[model samples]
Target chain A: MKAVERVDQFYLLKQLPKATALLCKEGNLLDASCSWLEIFGLPPINKKQKTQIFSLLPEVEDLIEKLQEAKSFNLRHEISLNNETRHLKSYFAPWFDEKENVIGTIVQTDDITSEVEKEEELNWLKNIMETKMEVSKTGWWEYEIDTEKLTWCKETKRIHQVPDCYEPTVIEAIEFYKSGYSQNKVSMLFHKAITDYQSYDTKVMIVTFNGEERWVRITGKPFIKEGKVAKIFGTIKDIHNQVIAEHRVKEHQQLLTTLVDSLPLNVYVKDLESRKVLVNKGECSYLHKKPEELIGKTDFDLYDREIAQISREEDIQVMKHLTPIIGKETVSCLNGKTTHFLTSKIPYFDLEGKVCGVIGMGLDITSMKKKQEELCDLIKITSMQNQKLISFAHIVSHNLRSHSANFSMLLGFLNSEKDQEERKRIIKMLTQASDNLLETLGNLNQVLDINTQESETKKTLNLKKSITGVLHNLSAFLENNDTQIINNVADDMVVKCVPTYLDSIILNLVSNAVKYKSPGRPPIITINAIKSDKGVLLSISDNGLGMDLDRYGDKIFGMYKTFHNREDAKGFGLYLIKNQIEAMGGSITVQSEVDKGTTFNVYFNEES
Target chain B: MCILMKKVSCIFIVDDDPITVFGIKKMLKSVADCKDIQIFQNGKEAYDALIERQNLGKPIPEVIFLDINMPIMDGWDFLDEMIELNITEHVVINMITSSIDPLDYKKWADFKDRCPYILNFKNKPIFKIEPNDLGCITAAS
Candidate 1:
């Protein structure tokens, strides 16, 4: 090459990104391209001049020895030239005349710093991603609309658990997702973004290289260029844990909501700043409004001023204590009525341990309190019964013992009298006293006998059988009273009762009917049974001498209280019958009038 | 006492009340011939006497007037004790009490299987007897 043309070629080479140089056998520069100067960032050099290349570029001395050992040799190596080592490729051969031999070594020095730096940055990013176990990286890939190029970021390969060395075609990458729904959805998303230039966000599962199924969220955005789709890009995120956590949170929230709604108690919560009310279903009715209506509204808007003020004060107290408070409060409604609530207010805390609002749960205790009062009344009645029984025992002992003592004393006097006539008269008086004593003893024994029958051993009995037994036993009495009996008792009706007590009850009622027949008409007795939800109702009605119900209905069951004066009528029979029936968990009621018939309804609890 | 033992066999009277026992014992003197007339206040004491005598190989009483109304142990309790020991069934047992309850009669009537040993239900005193006076023997087998 001639020297004049060499300068022009060297100038043109300086603008190239690659460096160039030429060296003679002595390691001096016979000629060097401008790229060499520019690579070292030095000034331009003169043409056709032998220069000391080592002095200018001290790092080139090691490269010269390597080049001399082999002819037509090429090598890539690094050297420290400007405080930083840069890689260079060199070619070496022997000089020849008109033959293919290297006259001097032609070394191409490339700065390659940018390329190496980019590779190092990529490796650093790879190591950071590989070590990150908590924040998993996901990726997506795309291709240009009209180009044969495919592009994927490192995160994209990682999301599919593919190695960095894996190079995939566009179609192959699309096939990595599950083949059915996922493949269809991804295909649709790609087609729509490419054709319509639309943006899409979707979630899908993909089978990774490691054979693990993973859920990823993809957000795709397309760019349009010249009315034609240019490129599409998207981001994929592992969102698996977040998705699972969100789903579990949703289920728990629904369960808690259902539990709160199903509870009989009223539950409500309010936001302090917004003054919005949130309530369970039961609490909605208590407010006389729907839950939606109550939402975004304060208690003052829906309730009376007193109620709102009291509720707000209660909420403030709850917030101050940061605990629950339980008590009773009267909530006045706009309807002009106040309801008593067994109320509990609690402060709800946010994640930062700050009180967000107050929650209140209440139970309406109006009916329960009424029932408690009734139970107290029953207790009082039981106490009165106990007192009455004690008094009865005392009366029996006093009256019977006194009469017996008088009879014994009279008999002793009769025995002491020596005069025959006076003894006879005294004996007669003693006999009369003894008879009175015996009568008193009988009455007392009858009363005490109830104590024995008080224990009602229950058994399942057919109503018809029991009534039939009573009728058969009272056949003679019914005939004597000339009474006609009509029985409409349900034959299959079964009741749980003490058999003996049931017999006695039936007999007493039937006999009463027969004895108290109306004077003008034959005594017609009706015995009917009805099955009700309460239990079996037994009604015994008689067209006999009925007393004025208004006057004696209240006292008919009282002890020693008799309305009829039949010779065999003992006032105590009906009284004992009523007590016996009541003690067996049954009740008795009588309806009668002065000239009309009497009907006694016996209600006994049915056995399940 | 030897002549009295010769004149009558032993008769045991069991009752709770002292007056009733005394009256029954006094009235029994006129009704039957008896040598040994023993009296016990309650069924427990009477049972003990019978057991003690039987253990000594002495014959138990041929006739026993058992009072149904006694505290701690009554005539039924005595009978139960006797039956458990397999006492002689030929010996007559009469339940004597002043209780005139129809339920008591019903209970006694229903117990006919154990009644051959029980001769009758008798009222107290045993003083008066008439041909049709079922009063002395309320029920008899």
Candidate 2:
């Protein structure tokens, strides 16, 4: 090996800033720069002594062997010089002789400590950015207006379902959006942002390369240079999942609204303040207002003060108790008509179990209430008729039994009689008893006829004329009894009544007055008629022996209730008259006093 | 069909129906042996006569056949008046009426507690003198 030219190597090594060194083929250090000595903390080498490179830096032992086995260039490694660690780039090249034969090798070393650390930090930062973009489903893009070049990041390519090396044009990028609204929206925004130097953030629907539709949010900003729009850059985010969830929520809300609006009942939701939040069609029509107009208004705004106060109190009770309140309410309409409703109010709760409002539901029950009242009235009438039937039976039995008993007694007398005259008298009594039995049966049959037959057919008859006809019919009896008949009814007064019932009623009244006359005073009968709203009031009053009403008020109209001792008093006259009046949809009431007079007020219903 | 019982003096028949009174008088003639027989149209007449006889210090009727359902005063009213008058005489009163009404029977039963003079309650149609009925009145006297 030729002698190494240390002077020339020292000059060349001094030109470089890093630590530089040269070693021989035997791996001994031939020359090193002053900076290298300073780095390794080594003293200057003497001319006669040899120091091996591996001994000076033990970290380079494997590197020296690699250089010896094969000629390597620029192989890098790290070594500790002195007590500090430094990273170095090494080169091992052989020097050639004139015959082009292998001579000694040149080992060049460079300290690259700062450069290595900087490159490692750059690589770490790049790794973090890539991971963040993948996790967030985000991508970025840039467009150069002059060159019309579109550049996309690695993440942007993945979002479009494109190959990593694929280059996209501005038109190709716009085509990725769904064809109609989404596509047009993006185009318009893009042009506007460029010309106006505006920035936009929007969500758009895009069809990927694989023909799958996806939702993306694009945020774009345009660069203005020299007072003119130049370039555009933006980010695209995949927001498919978020958009779908929002759409489902909207659809569910619409379904609930439709269900509430179509119910037949009056359905409403009110807030804690008693303000209406929601109302159905029934409530809207009932209030004579539209849903939009009624919303946010309280009952006070739609109803009178009295009704509104009641409604508000009910709502407050529901929320305060957190329970349902059910009751009946009467609502009067604007036309002065009243309606009844069966209403229920329930406390509405939020997701957190707080009572936030009340829900009111009501069903109109006015017609049902009316029907119930009518049913009660029918029951009362039925019970009254039943009582009358029981009384009639008892009267018939008593009258018949009395007559039969008298007949039996007379027959016994006749059988035991020894004298012919006595036997003849007994026979006459038996005949009289049988006649009384027949008469009682006839009266009972007349009473039964009034109960069974309908007397609905009515004819207009003059009141005075009808009374006169009845008086004429009973003229013989009236004259014999010396009864005075005074008809006070108006000549022109007309009444709606059945012809037979009217005649029977007047005749019975007149005969009763004559039959029950006081012994000292002659019977004076006064028949009067007056027109009233309840049809016509016909009063038949007599100055004859009037009964003591207090003693027999309840039984005055009962069958066989005789107040006087007259032999002809069958006691069926007043009973028959009352029944006949009632059968023709009329009522009869009597006012009487002992030895004074009796007045019968018959109220006939007007024919409709 | 005469009832051979002890003789009863001052027998009274009070009724509203003349036929009922005739029937009772005829039946009593066969059933009882009485010295004096008096007839009254209603309870009021009988009651007034009894009160008059008591006031005059005379003997009242020993037996009375009273009928119900009279015009001026019924059998119940006479009995009530008899109790108020405080008649000490031992009169045997029998209520005879054609009425089959159970109410009359119930009212008589209730009155039995107030007036012990009521001897028996008999239904009408006393066709002949029943020895058994006359015996009851005679035994009570």
Candidate 3:
């Protein structure tokens, strides 16, 4: 060894392996260990030259004050080496001479670059985890079974509104769960976790340290060591806002359900397929079904087929147009009894305002409809009575006045005549006129009695039975007249009418047929029934004698008007029958031709 | 039958009512004509007789007292037949009616507009007519 190297520490530092250096106050390198020289890209010690330390580490100049500190200090700074960024931490202690005067810094650096980078990455991950816990309103808590200690994270402390320095015990932590169900439940679960190593997840309400109530999700897991629970750690999430919103939604749903269920009318919600999705009490009762039985059923299942078809079509129309059908009167029948409903339906919209179904309400109006029908029948009967009175007045003036006029004319001739024989002849003509008046009065009386018979309840009579009975009575007369009778009335054909009036009507028509049998041919009278909207139409057609209907059509049903000149043609028969039919709310019409045939089409009240 | 002295050579008393027809026949013979008074029960028989007379070249009644209300055919129907057959060149129809019905008056008015052989539209009972009234009656056109 050189004699100077034995006393010089710088020369002795030359052989050190770690990066150690001696630097002056101006941040210039004085002596550096070989490892330091090698790491900083310097030459070996034997051929070393003074190198500028600040050139490679210009940022190190800011740490020069750290190098001069009396005790010891460390500094970290960045350097670029071989196009790679690296961090270095250097420790500096004051260098002293024998006289105790500071000269420069003895700097020892370690490539702590990897250590600083690892520490920086760890700090970044820790920051991210804390921020995530804060954002999610989640916090952790741990319980040590043996120590009976509970420790809370910063987020958990914040959730409980506890002071930062507060320490918690297991009993105090469980007390945070609001008393009763929440507190009791958590206590049981905590006991179970400690004893049986069970895991638990539950939602509970808690009272914070600040005396505010809150909802939270509590979860726990037990860690076992050697068949014994070491600790139980879990998350407690602040779920206050979410739980409150859910509570509001549940309340609203309950309110709507209660309101719809209480309505007396038939309220229903139908889906796009017109199936009953919801029905109120009234609808269930009207259909005679329970809610469970009625839900998911269609109108066709509850109503008659024809009525169901109409209801479904209306539902479709409402949904398609997105328009409401308000207060339309509809009819329903059950067990042969009819009911009326004032129904309204509106399109049921989804959240998007699209018509997804129909909501309908039906109000019972059967009694109101019945009253309206009664009013209509009253009006009809009043009009019919008025018609009867008018006809009565006209017949009295026309027929009776003519009779009185003849009496006056004959009485005047009897007084003016000079011969007794002519006077006697006038007296006999006067007697005949009086007899005609009496007969006219009797006919009018019978016509007036039609009102009484009409007031009686009508009965359903089979047309075939009535026709057969009449034909049996007329069999002898028909045989004498050589009349061919064709009774074509169906056996099931029925009409509602007064019995005696029907008998008289049949007798009058049949007698007229036989009385007016054709001189050239035997009479052919056909009686048939056909269904009509008004009722069963009985057609009594004859081939005996047909008058010129075109000329005398207006007077065919007139009092004392005859279409045939037969001696027995009373002319009052058709008029009487017409009055009877009109009083009973039926009608009669005739079609005839000269010398062809006459057909009397009579309509009776429909059987109820 | 025809008579030279009777004002109407053959007068027809067509009525459904016997009393009315008897009174008219007696009055026509006593006040209007002396003989050849023809009687019919209704307008249908009256119309048939007129058609028969026209077909057989017999003398048609000079004056037909036709009643408005009759069976099978009425006075209006008889007049319709008369107008259709064109046989009223020399005959006159006196429409007799007891109808106070306005419809009858309207119908008579309608026939008056259509026919030239309407002599008169009279009320019931020709017993009130005098011989001078019958002489004054004549066809309007």
Best by lDDT: 3
lDDT of 2 by residue, A1-608 (tens): 12356555467765557566666667777677777766666776556788776775565547655656646566667667566777777667775579966555666667789999889889988888778888898999999899999999988888889899999999999999999999999999999988888899999999998998999999899998998778899999989888998888878887877877777678899999999998998888877789999899998887788888988998988899887887656564544667778898999999999999999987777788889888888887788788777766667777777788898888878877899988888887777777778888888888888888774478898888998888888889999998888888988999888889899998888888888888889899888888887789999898878887876787778776666766777667888989988877789999998889898899987763
Strongest candidate by DockQ = 3
Tens digit of per-residue lDDT, candidate 3, span A142-229 = 9888887888998899899999898888879989999999999999998898888899999999999999999999999999998899
Task: Encode model 1's per-residue lDDT on A1-608: one tens digit a residue.
Answer: 56567666655555555567666667666555666766556566654465665665555557556656646666555666678777555555455447755566655666666777788999998777555532556565666767746677777788888889888776887787788998899889888988788899998888888988777788788877888878887778777778788889999999999999998988888776427567898888877788788888887887878778888887888888887888665545658766667888888888998999888788888677668889998897688678658656654654454445445545655555577986776666666667766776786675566555565577889999999988998888788878788999878988888787788889888888887788899999899998889888999998878887664566677554455544555556677678766666678999887668899999997642
The interface RMSD values of the models, given in order, are 13.3, 2.0, 1.5
Where is model 2 chain B poorest over a 10-residue stretch in terms of lDDT?
B132-141
Q: Candidate 2, fnat value?
A: 0.53
Docking class of 3: acceptable
Sorted on TM-score, highest at the top, how do the candidates line up?
2, 3, 1
In angstroms, give how far residue A445 of model 1 lies from its true place: 12
Q: List RMSD in Å for every model shown.
A: 19.7, 11.6, 8.7
Q: Please report how far candidate 2 places residue A215 from its true position, in Å.
A: 8.7
DockQ of the two-chain complex in candidate 2:
0.38
- Ordered by lDDT, highest first, the candidates read 3, 2, 1
Give the poorly placed runs of model 1, Cα more than 4 Å off: A1-140, A147-149, A178-180, A194-198, A221-231, A272-276, A285-288, A296-311, A327-341, A364-370, A420-608, B1-141
Measure candidate 3: CA RMSD: 8.7
